[model samples]
Target: MSGDDILELENFLPYRLNRLADAVSRRFAKTYRDLNGLTRPEWRTFATLGQYGSMTASGIGAHSTMHKTKVSRAVAALERRKWLTRTPDPVDRRIEHLRLTKAGIAAYREMVPLARGFETDLLGHLDEQTRRAIVQGLAALEQAADVD
Candidate 1:
């Protein structure tokens, strides 16, 4: 098949989504690592906490679709870095709830603009209507998948 006759991967959803997610993740990981020394899992943990404050480690794992062990390890690493704090749940003394430290909050705040700029650059070429449609479609997919 001639190159001109070939349909490129841009038309395939799974391949395109995986590639896009990996590329974006790698870029974001590098940026965050330089700024805060965060690994991918650690960054995931921080992002989860930044969105949902004070959750049990298990809750984080569930919400992030990560294994409990990975979540626990990331929590420990973040705690050691003073980026997060763990405290016993008042009602469930056996469960430790996680919260972002001041430093963690500040780091998240600093990363937001950079992250937004990166996302904006990625989507900037698309017209507003296409962008909105894409977002709505993705949201619907996530909802259908019960990604809560």
Candidate 2:
């Protein structure tokens, strides 16, 4: 093989991780599109709002692993749909606190079972122990990357 064509698993982590993430996203989008017609960012926004109840845009950004600008855009889209409502933080007018609207909550409730099934199918090959280990390892990698 040419030097340029050499393959090594250790050196391919980033490529593999990106490809896996993309594939999972594509599969999920295909699987869940009919149920809710949710885009990735829209689903992410709903998830963050549902879990945390209420949070500023920066908080959602951190939880969603998305940029502040992306979060802002998503929030705007959700607001336009009336799926979520944003209020100016009383304590800090500059920050907008977001909450899921009743519509958002109902939509989320309806989608939960489908989402769970999608996740379950995605991890069907792995046993619980292996799945936990993989999750822990990925969390460790994310933490390590955050360090200087």
Candidate 3:
């Protein structure tokens, strides 16, 4: 194959998406990290619990697209901070359900506004039509990828 047939790394859709995701994640992480001293995984775990009420670590991992080990460490960190509690599943001896504590809930609530602000700031750079186009394009890409 000629060099003309080779993919350009900078222009590749997957590479661009990954780079954008990383940049956005890091930008948002500053809010939670500065205010709550939470790592990305810990903040994700906490947010998942806050949104879903109660779930197993495996569930959190699936929802967050995080590995099992990352989820475990995040759970442990949140537990240490008294931001989460674990309860044994009634029907499953080995399964433990996790939920956010009152403190965790408070933190999540506080962070929501900050997150919204960050999103607003980022999207503000685009015009209304551009923003809508970007959203529609992302939806189409997700559909094409069979993402849930």
Candidate 4:
């Protein structure tokens, strides 16, 4: 194949972005994983609930950009661990609001500082100029794509 015709996967924007996201997530995952044995989905769900106080499965899935199945499984796992509870809405029997229990809250609180520190460490690798440029570039891309 000619040099111009060859597709370099690593240099592709989407592929690069996806790879970077995965790598960052994996690095961050180690922190929460050690904190309370939380998988990515569980951590997302827990963090969502922790941030929002209470939310439905669909809400958590949408907010966290996780698949419904993953959200359901995380919910089940958290429930099994007595970290969260589901309550049927007063008027809507089909909808359940998920909230973290006191134990879950404690766990979430503990993870917060660790999560913040991890982010600080990640950003610390980049100089201020590069970090600002990256943030601006990502924001521009998101705006161009009309991402919500």
Candidate 5:
């Protein structure tokens, strides 16, 4: 293959985006992990239920972009910790609705301010113009990617 056929990973958009996403996730993970020993999927599952009240495992997976296995594991972990309750549907025993328990709500409330602070601090590094540009660029990228 000639030089023209070679793909430079360093200059690739998808690679750069993936690296940025991983770094950001890790940074935020430290906040919740330190407080609750939660993994990324666990945190995502908890936060999704906290924000949206109750939902089925498949619903959580779709809403959070997590795979079914990840959602199942997170839900199981949270249930074991007594942070969430799983109630079987009245008509469909196979379907279970997951909701944050009082303890989980308390934990979520505690994290809300910290989560906001983290976002604030992260954005504080950028000037207003750059921040607006970044937000616009990301919105455009999401649209282009057909992200719902």
Candidate 6:
């Protein structure tokens, strides 16, 4: 097939979404990275635990769409920083439940406002209607893709 008949990745929905997500993530990463020297996986794991209270490494990986190795490294990093603790599950000796420490909670609280500001700054560039439309369109697309 001719190049003209081939799909353009730049214009593809999946590619566009991935590109947008990476750009947004990098923009937001600066806040946590500068404040706490956290990497993307570490930040994601920390945020997931902060939001969800306690969960297993597998749960965090699933929730954040991260790989097992990434989750493991993040967990280890946070543990070394005294920001998270792991407790052996009573019913399952092989499973460990992870939770944020007091320090982690404090960090999470400090980062919340920064995260909100970052989101506000980005969304503020768009008009109210456009922002609403973007939100609604994203929801529709997620539903269409059968993503939770």
Residue-wise lDDT of candidate 3 within 52-104, one digit each (tens)? Answer: 99999999999999999999999999999998999999999799999999998
Clashing pairs counted in every model: 0, 0, 0, 0, 0, 0
Predicted candidate 6 versus true structure: per-residue lDDT over 1-118, tens digit per residue: 9988999999999999999999999989988999999999999999999899999999998999899999999999999999999999999999999999999999999999999999
Q: Which ten residues in a row have the lowest lDDT in candidate 3?
A: 107-116
Deviating ranges (above 4 Å) for candidate 3: none
Superposed model 2: Cα runs more than 4 Å off: 1-11
Q: lDDT for each of the candidates?
A: 0.88, 0.83, 0.93, 0.94, 0.96, 0.96
Per-residue lDDT for 5-112 in model 5, tens only?
Answer: 999998999999999999999999999999999999999999999999999999999998999999999999999999999999999999999999999999999999
Q: How displaced is residue 121 in candidate 3, in Å?
A: 0.7
lDDT of 5 at 52: 97
TM-score of each: 0.84, 0.81, 0.95, 0.94, 0.95, 0.96
Model 3 clash tally, residue pairs:
0
Q: Which consecutive 10 residues in model 6 have the weakest lDDT in total?
A: 139-148
C-alpha-based local distance difference test score of model 3: 0.93
Segments of candidate 1 deviating more than 4 angstroms: 1-12
Error of 3 at 110 (Å): 0.5
Give the per-residue lDDT digits (tens) of candidate 1, residues 63-147. 8788988888899999998989989988989999899999989988888888888889878989999999989999998898787
lDDT of 1: 0.88
